[model samples]
Target: MLREVVTTRYVTPLREGGSLPAIVEADDLGMYVVKFRGAGQGHKALIAELVSGELGRGLGLAVPELVTVQLDEAIAKGEPDQEIQELLLASVGRNLGMDYLPGSLGFDPVAFPVDSEQAGRIVWFDALIGNVDRSWRNPNLLRWHGRLYLIDHGATLIFQHNWPRDAGALEKSARKAVNLEDHVLARFAPDLRAADAQLAPMVTSEAVDAATALIPDEWLVGEPGFDSPDDVRRAFRDWFAARVRAPRSDWLPELAR
Candidate 1:
C-alpha cells in the first residue's frame, strides 16, 4: 500500500490537464499534485497513474513519488469555483497524488538534450505500456534540477479502459505495434535495441507483481469480468509479463533501433 496522507489545504487547480489535477498541501507537510477520483477520467485514471508510475520507477526511470491522498470534502467549502467545489465533494475518499516539483520547466528537446541511452530507456518504457500521450505537442515530462522526470501516466495502459471478454486479448495486445512517429523522444534516435537488452530482463514476474501490488484495492473494484481486485491485478501482471517476452519487432519502433 502507498503511504497515506490527508489533504491539509487545497492550493489551486492546474488547468492545464483535462482532468483538472490540483496542487494541494498534505498533512505530511509535502505539497503534491493530486489527481481527483471524481475527475472526468474516473478511478481507472488513478489506477493507471499508480500502476504506470510505479512501473516506470521500478524500471529505473525518473518518475515523481506517488502517494494515496485522503481528501475531506470540507476542504471545498472555501473554494469559490462551483466546478471545483463539486469535484472536491465527489472526490471525498481516496485519490492519487504525486510529489510536487517546484519550478520545473516543461521538457524542451532543444533546451535540454537527452542522451540516446536515457532516451532509449524512456521510449522503451513508454512503449511497454502503450502510452499514447507522450507526444511532441505534450511531452508530459518536466526538467527539474537538471534532470528529466516523467509524469501524468493516467493516459497509458489504455487496454484496461475496455476490458475484453476474450481471454487471449491480453496476449494479443502485448504484441501490437506502436507508432512512435510523434513520440517526443523519437528525435533522439533512441537505441531501443540497447535499451531492450538492458531493461527488458529486469521486468521479471516479481517486478510486475510489485508494481501492480501498489495499486489500492478500491481502485481495482468493479472492473468487469473480474471477481476481485486481485484478479484485475493479475490481469495487469500477466499482460506486462507477456509483453516483455514478446518479439521486439511487435512493440519497439524500427526507427528507434
Candidate 2:
C-alpha cells in the first residue's frame, strides 16, 4: 500500500512520458513515477499494470520496483473515474505504487540494453494477454544500471466487460491475440514462460479482497472488487486459463499448472 504525500512534496511531472506520469518524492520512500487512469481504458488497467510489473520483477526480470500513490486533480486529467478521482482526493493519499526506474532510458530498440533473446520473454508475456502497449514507437521499456526494465502496463489485459456495447465501430477484441514481430517470436518462441499462469494465482480471491480494501469504497460502491473481489479475480482467471492458454504451447501449460 502507498499514500498520497509524505515528508516531501511532488516536484513535477516526468515530461518524457507520453502518458503524463508524474515524478514525486517521499522522504522515506524515495522517488516514484505515478500514472493515472482515465477515459480510454479504466483504473483496472492500473491494477493490471501493478500486477504485471510486480510479477515480472518476481520472475527475476530487471523490472523497476512497484509502488502505489494517489494523484491530485491538478495533475490528473481525462480520468472519467469520478469514484476513483474522488477517492484519490478524499483520503489525503491512496495506494498508487511506484516502480523506481531511475537512470532508465525510455523505449528504443537499437539503444536497448537487452539482448534479442530476452526480448521474447516480454513479448511472450504480452502475447498471452494481448498487451499492445509496448510497441516500437512507444516501447514501455527503460534501461537502468545496465539492465532493461519494463513499465507503464496500464494498457494491457483490457477487461472485455468494459467495452461499450453501443460503441458502434468501436467493438474491440479480447486480450487473446497479440501482435509480435518475427524476431520476438523467434527468441522466446521455443520457451515462452508461463507468465500468465504464474501471475494469475497471486491475484487470487484473498489478494483481490485485500486490494479492494485499499480502493476507496466509492470506486468499489458496486464494483466487482467491493461486492466480490472474487468476481474480478474470476474474470482474470477465465481469460487467462481459458483463452490465454487455449493454445497448446508448452509455456502456457507450464504456467497454467
Against the reference, the lDDT scores of all candidates come to 0.88, 0.51
Q: Which stretches of candidate 2 lie over 4 Å from their true place?
A: 1-7, 15-19, 37-41, 70-92, 160-175, 182-221, 224-226, 248-257
Q: Which candidate is the best by TM-score?
A: 1
Task: Name the regions of candidate 1 deviating beyond 4 angstroms.
Answer: none
Best by lDDT: 1
Candidate 2's C-alpha lDDT?
A: 0.51
lDDT of 2 by residue, 166-256 (tens): 3231222332355455322233333444444454444344443443344433333356323554455444444444443244342232211
Q: What TM-score number comes out for model 2?
A: 0.65
Measured over all alpha carbons after superposition, the RMSD of each candidate to the real structure, in angstroms, is 1.3, 7.4
lDDT of 1 by residue, 6-67 (tens): 99999999999999999999998999999999999999899888888988898889999999
TM-score of each: 0.96, 0.65
Q: Give the lowest summed-lDDT range of ten residues in model 2.
A: 248-257
